[model samples]
Target: MIVVGIIGRPDSPWCHDATACLVVDGRVVVALEQERLSRRRFAPGEGPEETLRLLLAEQGLRPSDVDAIGYAWADATPEIARRVDSALPCGVLGTDRLTETVFPTLAAELRNKEIFFFDHHLCHAAQTYWFNPHRDADVLVADGTGGAGSTSLFRVRDGRFELLDRYSPLWSIGIFYEAAAFYAGLGWDAAGKLMGLSSYGRPSGRRFMTFDDGAGEFRLDPALRGLPSGGFTEERLAHEWTAIFEASAFPYAAGASNTFDYATFATDVQETVEDVGMALARRLRRRSGHDALLVAGGVALNAHLNRRLALESGYRRVSSTTAPHDGGAAIGAGLLAASVLGEPVRRRDPADPLPIFLGPAVGTAAIEAALDAESVPRQALEPEKLRAQVAEALDRGEIVAWFDGPIEVGPRALGARSLLSSPRSRTTLDRLNVIKGRAAWRPAALALTGAGFDAIDIEPAVAGLTEYMLCVHRVGERDWDRVATGVHVDGTTRAQHVADGSEFGALLGAVGRVSGLPGLINTSLNLRGRPMVLTPAHAVELFAEAPEVDLLVMPPYLVRRP
Candidate 1:
């Protein structure tokens, strides 16, 4: 059976989205996010039409070949925009036109495929449990808002999912963090900025939100209680967030003030969120009597908090998939819909539940064509010679744009699509930030072979998620200086472990043989705020634009700007 799952609704105020998964006979054949195809970061307010079209064309399939289509939202009602002439990506269709005309056209375009809608939170839960290695585990789904609620806890056993509890959107941890991000003088989408900034300062003694795990309750200041439940205009959310922070006794730095005070606030918010997350994990573990835990939702992307849960929280195993965010929701929606229809669900290997190569693979021919089209200088080398050249480039502190195989599905760049530099170089971090147009404070991840773990101190809990770069783990104090370029201010590193015998492992091995350190600083292969380079053309474009990139490696081919 061919099952295609899509995330995001045509009528809903969500557009920088839409991810699709094509499953055949219980196995995922392809998974692609709309943002990659649209060349828009997050591609808000856009449906997966372009993405689906591209995937189908690439796979030699047609819409008529699909058995069932699953949408991520259930009963997602469209809302009237409070303001006219809005250019918000989520409101691209003009909220008024969505329900009346847009969605109908979208539904009709699917032709004869049967459509199924799954609850938003159910999809989040499914994203974790369905493909998770643990057959029976406690699952936590926390996000801005799902169809049922913002936060959901579930227990899974023998392929059966039981909801243990849910928290209303009014008490959503995700929204609170978003508010914190807004108050930090950043866009709501830049919550990860606040997380990164949190590492630079010590915690302030004040708390902006409170959580009572024993009672299963959480609250923002009572003064902000009047904010709409499950929905809020950006203007309203921003205004209320400013007012709440200003009115509270909490210590907030001047909006235009020094970095120390801003970082202090960031630290406070980060520490508080982690505290609540840990408490929730403890409660879930006790209630479900399960040793393993699977975390899903946008909040799961907070590497800092995920690290805390992995190391400090008392769970035997804590793991999350590559697409823990909404992009992964499409895969979950398909799996859940398949199960509801009595189809066998393909369980991902626990050790490697989601393959690193889920996205489209660009072949050497494609790379050659792109290089030729661009009229760029290049050379073709044997496999060993190519690895040596790339590794030697890194050893000389040159930034190498590495496009090995299929693109990575999630936000983080695994080995497949990465910009690599010597992690030991002190100035490499700053140069990388400049290359990607990222904030100087944002930290890069370290990609290494499995043996790379020997040089670092990784807690057992965090060890589980090393493959996907889901959790942050503290670098050994002794090794901190060795991998300083990849270590955050807090002495933590978001690391991706390359499995032995993989092509990436061999590359890291080459680097290790030369440098004695089996790792390099790896960031997503794209410009700052840009979607990852999805095609050879995209990679060539980025290589041409990023002057700091010294070499562009497309396997047997290499391109260097004169």
Candidate 2:
């Protein structure tokens, strides 16, 4: 049965359902992003016409080929939520109103296939468990709030997934980090900026607030609904977030404070997060008596936290997928739909060698057309040639925008949709951010390649699992001078270790061979305050807008001419 799982919120820009995966005959097929074909970023509200068309055409799937449709979002968000009255500062947005848009759409789409509506958090839990390696792992769900729960906890037992608890998007860990990003004066959807910033400073009671007076725990806090009526305006959120930052961690040093807070704060933040995580991990470990813990949520992006949870937490095992955020929920919704229909569940172990090539694969023709349209210089660099040239650019300190392969599913730059450059020079770092029109202080990331990580001084667990640039790595003593600009103020670097032959790997080899640096300063291919560049057109427009970007490597073609 061709079951398409979709996840698009009401009033959101595009229908995310088109990218939904269907579990068929024990194989994971069907992972599409609405934007790739439609050429929009998070195109919410719009139908998945292009996706359905492309699916049917590319896979020889007809409309009738679809047996069922599963929505990642709740049919009615309210019906699923446990009415969170009196929200916390960063709690879920409007936990009170159910997303009523699900029903009418499901009913409409059902004419072609059986439509299934799932509770939002349940979908998140499904993602947690589906990606979990352990059969009976406890589940943790985290995201920007789905009606009520921005972050939630769950447990998997006896072939079933269950929720342990729920938390609102407000006072939410996601929002807290988000607020920190904003406080650092970064752009929207730029939590990475906070991670980068956190690398520069020590957590001096400024960026953290205790849950209890001296609980040593921190939460994104704001005023709750003091009245019987429960509702808070966006203005209120902005006001409260502003207050918290003013009262707490707003550094006022014009003398150029250490840009290394990310290390200390990330370390402290990771440690503090581990404190909460360890408490929860211990509780779940004791309650379930199962060694494995499955965590899903945007917070899962905290690699430093993840390392602590995996190494220090009480759980015997920890599992999270490369795409554990909202995007992966599309996969979960499909899995759930398959399960509910009495279809046999075939689990894909996260350990079974899963590389996150989840989104639509752009055709070479499309890429060529884009290159031709831009009249950019063209040449397919053989592995060695490209490597040497790219290395030369890096050694010379050029900011190159790298877009290769299928776009990664989640909200990370990864190596697929990254910008590359020199991390060694303060001038290069400043130029890159200025090119991005982002905060001048924001640090760039490094995409390492091969097994040469030991040669570069960095904290353990960082250079190893940097396949995705999710976690912050501690820069070691020797590499500090080289990666100073790339390393956050706190001395941590978000690194993506690329395998030897992949696009990222090749790029790394090139840079390493030339400059003796494993990778370039990495960042997404997007302007500040925008989503990553999703297509050739996006790349073209972006380069046109920001002329300083020296080159764009789209494989077989490079864009350097205006």
**What is the clash count of model 1?**
6
Candidate 1 per-residue lDDT, tens place, 1-562, comes to 7888788555455544688888777767788988888888887777777777777767888766776766677645345422223211111111223322333543454554555666677777777776677878888888777755778888888677777888766666777778777777766677788888888887765666677777877755454324444365444545566666655524443254444457877887888778878878877887898888889998898888788777777887888888888888888778766665567885667555356577865778898889889898898899999988888889998999999887778888888888899998878778888998887777788887767877566543254477788878777788787888888888888888777688888999999888887888888889977888888999899988889999999888887769
TM-score attained by model 1: 0.91
What would the per-residue lDDT of candidate 2 be over residues 330-440, giving only the tens digit for each residue? 777777777666676666654454546665567888888887786766778765676577678778878788778777666667777877787688888888878778777
Off by over 4 Å in 2: 9-27, 32-56, 75-112, 157-159, 167-171, 179-190, 199-275, 349-353, 462-465, 559-562
Candidate 1: pairs in clash: 15-44, 15-45, 15-46, 16-43, 16-44, 16-45
The positional error of residue 135 in candidate 2, measured at the CA in angstroms, is 3.2
Task: TM-score for candidate 2, please give it.
Answer: 0.79
Tell me the lDDT of model 2 at 164.
56
CA lDDT of 275 in candidate 2? 54
Q: Judge candidate 1 at residue 168 and give its lDDT.
A: 69
Instruction: Looking at model 1, report the run of 10 residues with the lowest lDDT sum.
Output: 86-95
